[model samples]
Target chain A: MVASSTARTGAGGQTLVVDLAYPPDPGRAPFTRADLVVTGVDHSGTSYEVRLYLDNPGADIDTPRDPEAGYAGRYTVFGHGGCYGDEGHCEVPEAAGDPTDVRPVHQLTPLDTFVTVTDALRRVLDRDGRLSTVTMVPVSLTPRRSDRSPAPELLEFADLSLHTYLAATDLDVPTPG
Target chain B: MGVRRSAASLSVAELTDLRDAFTALYGISDDRGYAFLAGVHGLPLPQYCKHGSILFLPWHRAYLYFMERAMIDALRRSRDDPAAAVSLPWWDWSSAAAHADGGGLPPGWLAPADGGANALASGPMTLGDADLEQVRTNLPGAVTDGADPVTVRDPDTPDQLPKATTVNRALSATSFTEFSQIVEGIHNGVHGWVGGAMSAVPIAAYDPIFWSHHAMIDRLWYLWQLSPQGADPSAALLDTALPPWPMTVRQTLSVPNLGYDYAAQVVG
Candidate 1:
């Protein structure tokens, strides 16, 4: 398996603080790059936007158009049924949507984006030597539902799935070769 | 006004008698017991079940609710009939401590025999330390050591299990906001799939109380759905897929087709 490594260093007496924003309540929805705020110390000590991209594909609700569209499509349907309606509009039933298409062609925030951003941050910190602590804040990205209402906020499930995803980035492991 | 009997007041014998009546009503026998029981629990047999699926919570809740309702109905029927010979018995786990302590005749308690030596009897006979260890490791924060506080009582009885007592206390002590917080703590990480397609996780079958615990969990989910605070947003998202066989919500919602119904008042 191919492994990737990155590091950031603290420069000239300044401490590098990595604040990872997460939703205060994780059960509401998942955090995405769109919900991120990455600021780090540059050479002049000014906070700059450290471009963040996760290693996973962009976050898209997986609505499969075909048989092979797989697990993502199923999750999309389930989530769709769960949050189909808005304040005034009635929720759409799963059957009301088009069939024969196993997957829906919706824009998705890839899981890898988080990994990529974390990798980049690690590399920068390793290079700078001013790195201090890393903090993660879970935040919510709006869902592209028909209602266009704000996505409900979420609290993270206290499970290994998300933790493992974050750990892979923290450790700077490459996508397994 | 007439006094009402709640699930919280059933005895173990009453619960067992109800189980038998339901089994008879459905023509269930030992040969097809698992499938019948699975139906009672709103699950397809393991052979039809997918590994690492999200159906765990909803499916099991449906199953237990069916059982609770069946038991409740049977008790009411028995109360109205002079010919009714069997009464509901409650397996009060809190009383187990006193029973162990040599206290005479723990109240609202019944011996395991009333269950007719079924799979649930194994729960009292063996501890299965290894299984308990796995359950502990996977599900941290389980109350361990002091006494076997996990009670399996007929839903119609008020016999209190220690764990149920604690849960009741927590629910009663907290304001609605605090209760919501407490529930959230328990509900977190609750949605996940365990085991792969090839391997089966036997945790569901480890004890008979697994059904009841899951029933309680489902009840919490129902309550959460109705809470003014809002349903768990994460729950709104489907992170998993339906199995290959095409199924619709209509197919799933029908009780006779599924072979059971939710207790009349429980869902309300």
Candidate 2:
């Protein structure tokens, strides 16, 4: 409902460059705030990407153009998960050498799906940590593959749940005071 | 060597053999190809999943069995030993071995020499469009071109992986949904723990350890089936057919009937 109308890039609204490789290889851990994370709170506080999970197949995710570019969808409670935080900031790097890379516009559905998944996510700090994640992706004007490339339907999404799981940090997600 | 053992009990040599076999499959780009093998996952055709549904345990059980058979065949052909019985090992991240060293990634997957080629991180891969589009155009039996990849950034941090007790707790759920979801929670944790190519749902199978990770998941389900609370699904769920997959929920319930089993009792 209440969200900023601008997609959060980096410190001063700059899109951060990230290297993505599949058949996953070892890389940096979620050691700092700069590392991309997934959560219920959006880092930008605005320009929210409304993502939908696999359970919902008939959800609307079309984003209005012009001044309402990224804010067409509902508040993306299931926060950012990939590198560069929000979907708006991530792009497939220019030089995709041997293993190729491409920036597929990640898509998300409008909010309203309730009781998503309420399961236990064990935490080293807490014994009974339950992970009740809210899912979201960018408001896609069209459908495509997980790579963010243009596809037919806008209903699909990459199962980036773990990215959200590993990247959850207190920095991005503020505690209600 | 025939059964799927825990990553902790495995020797570096044994892990190396599995690693090499996995890589060998990756090299095949045709039917029953490496990419095809990996494509049978969640990306393009996210259908017929044995998760959030009745087939969650059985479907994966069948998938793992098929994979083991493929590995056995590969080993026989490549090594020219008809008796090269090498079943993929399982990595119970919640176990002690996960906390041993470089996260849950065994030395074979991390070591530059042994599993270096098959090491998901050791190789160079450009992450982008080509991969997402692979299943739709290249691979077979995908959904209506609607799928997503799994997300993982760092795959070798030990602390990042789940503990054995964490998984044991998942087995305590009373209902099928509770048990499956908790099990999946652990499954998702490992994928994220071994982030990188293994993070995405579709491309996870490409990683050598993905099968092992899923094996652990499947094994947990097996353990549940043997428990007191575990029972057959209700009629509606049992009859529900997983699309693009010929088998129904009832068809995938048994591991013994599917042939092969996991090694040792993965005590909760």
Candidate 3:
């Protein structure tokens, strides 16, 4: 990972903002590509969509999904609905359940989602040279119960990071060989 | 042994046999019934599934195997000889043809069956009072008052379906974990694109197309497993148990060992 940043959910779980910077040197950049890696994504609730915008501070659900608007890309989480099993069945054990237990981890365990935003990141970098904050707009598709005491949150993730990678160096060749 | 083919390539006879199997299974009305198998995915009691975990792919593979085997049993009960020949066909939603016509739903799944309801398009969502509450618990206002609440779909435009490039990139993944997440994201997008009951996980499996959709995902994993860049899952993951089904991750890795293999597309 070359250039990276991390962030949690924003106020009211409406949006998330994370700081992302461009590589220092473009001529001989260390990284060949970039990606937006979302880690520890909780899929135990209703499904929803998260639209990522590069640097548009005012980006919202109404924002146009295009490069001009800093709309990088979007991804959806197919939620597991909710736990209907017996008590503790859906709980992610802090440690292994039992020493001899062979059962897999809870189905609702947090997972990771990765999106290769190379083109989007490059477009922003080329224009501004150095890119900053990424704004995410979350929209829940599942209908919630109006009478429920507390509304269930649609967006839950541990961290949103920008990761860059290095490709194999180009082969050296003699001039006019 | 069974050979699963792309849903688009199934012959008229093959489609008929598959539909017949569904009808036969639907009629059983017992634990072996279609509804019972479908409910096992989500809703009612025992929502045996593994999503958002490393076991996501392998668990669903075992689930599909269980359902396919039950379909064979249903065909056998109806005295349909060579029942084993009929394996579940996958809806290739990420193919060139799928995205060509604005990304329409699979015609075989949507088309009406001979002289009546198409079991492929939709099937009876037999939910009891408790089960109905379970649906509303997650989905809120789904399954309103109705005598026959058959599964319904409100699919998005074909353009909304995942592009072939999206899936091709997932297939190119070097690690099983990376491959699963990419493919799973695509899977989630397709589920939401299908909307209606299909969009919600609790009642998703009740829709007949869910089986084929998962079959498509399972097929992708099978292809990835055989690819040069593909590597076997970690040792711990391979040995983990997918409950409600007796199989482990290792057992589900080999499609042929589970008695089925996806057929190579028959190009003209």
Each prediction's TM-score against the native?
Answer: 0.32, 0.54, 0.87
Q: Report how closely model 3 matches the true complex, as a DockQ value.
A: 0.31
Candidate 1's residue-wise lDDT over B137-253, tens digit each? 433222233344221222212221223333342243213333433332222111111111000122222234344334444444444444453233233333434333244322333
DockQ for each model: 0.02, 0.03, 0.31
**On a 0 to 100 scale, what is the lDDT of residue A103 in model 3?**
54
Order the candidates by lDDT, highest first: 3, 2, 1
C-alpha lDDT score of every prediction, in listed order? 0.28, 0.45, 0.75
Tens-place lDDT per residue, model 2, A27-102, is: 3233222212223222111112333222112222332221112111121222112232235433334444655543
In terms of TM-score, which candidate is strongest? 3
User: In model 2, which regions exceed 4 Å deviation?
Assistant: A1-177, B42-54, B113-153, B243-245, B265-268
For model 3, which pairs clash?
A: B102-B158, B103-B158
Query: What is the C-alpha lDDT profile of model 3 across B25-132, one tens digit per residue?
Result: 888888888888888878766677767667889999999998888888888877657534568999998777777764467788884546566778877788887667
RMSD of each: 19.1, 15.7, 5.7
Better of 2 and 3 by lDDT: 3
**Shift in Å, residue B77, candidate 1:** 14
Model 2 chain A lowest lDDT segment of ten:
A113-122
Candidate 2, backbone clash total: 38
Candidate achieving the largest DockQ: 3
- Model 1: how far is B222 from its true place, Å? 2.1
Docking class of 3: acceptable
